[model samples]
Target: MKLIDTKNQLNDKEKHIGKVVGVDNATLTNIQLKAGEEIAEHDSKNEAIIIVRKGKVRFTVEGKPVEVTPEHILHMTPLEKHSLHAIDDTDLVLVQVKP
Candidate 1:
């Protein structure tokens, strides 16, 4: 009964790459990265699924290196330590579920 056009949410401000696009039962974030950009190490406060919308990214999850490409997805559990880097220009959607 709802529709979200993710493409319109893409935003390229000074030095930004992520934005909260929706929040209800779950939190949805639109994340984009220019080549060589990175999201420093952090912990997920809730369960999250990172959906690759375009390009590629290198994700270090719990110290394990993984490459996620378009159409691929990465899951993170609560308090999971992870980091992400764009090997190329990339766009992603992060949906986090509240516990």
Candidate 2:
């Protein structure tokens, strides 16, 4: 078995993005953003599931605003445009599955 560490160690002024795993038809990504940082609008070709592990963010999905917190999870279909702003220092895991 292989082991992967998915951890966020960013300081208050830092942000990070990285791939944690990729196997067959699926991929796992780790995204961490400091408060006020944003990811500009973009779309994925694969289906996506976003798990919020800590802090809060406001996601603009197709021009609509959705607030997400650590207690919430988000999903998107292929090619659905979305962007996000960190409402607080945040840690997120993105899982993408191919068709």
Candidate 3:
């Protein structure tokens, strides 16, 4: 069994927003976003589920912006463009389903 503590894994230095703690054969990564930071527009080859753990964020998927706050989750299919902004100091987890 593998267990991870999101708070500890996040390094506040390297990533101004948050750190990507990779696990499960790189199938999942957790990102911590500082207030006012953002994950610029981009796309992925694998499907991903974004789970908001702490604070809030604006998640733009396929050009549609959705507000995701703590306890909220959003899914994005492969090749779907998206972006995220930290409405507050946010903790996000990205679970990528590898092909």
TM-score of each: 0.84, 0.92, 0.80
Weakest 10 consecutive residues, lDDT, candidate 3?
8-17
- List model 2 lDDT by residue over 1-99, tens digit each: 998896776863488999999999999999999999999999999999999999999999999999988788899999999999999999999999988
The positional error of residue 51 in candidate 2, measured at the CA in angstroms, is: 0.1
* Model 2 misplaced stretches (Cα beyond 4 Å): none
Which candidate comes out best when scored by lDDT? Answer: 2
lDDT (CA) for every model shown? 0.81, 0.91, 0.76
Deviation of model 1 at 48, angstroms: 0.8
Which candidate order results from sorting by lDDT in descending order?
2, 1, 3
Candidate 1 C-alpha error for residue 37, in Å = 0.2
Stretches of model 1 off by over 4 angstroms after superposition: 8-15, 18-20
lDDT of 1 by residue, 1-99 (tens): 577655533254422445566566688888877778899999978899999888899999999999999867898899989999998878888898988
Which candidate number would show the highest TM-score if scored against the true structure? Answer: 2
* Model 1 worst lDDT window (10 residues): 8-17
Candidate 3 Cα RMSD after full superposition onto the native fold (Å): 3.0
**Which lDDT tens digits does candidate 3 get at residues 33-65?**
677888889999988888888889998888899
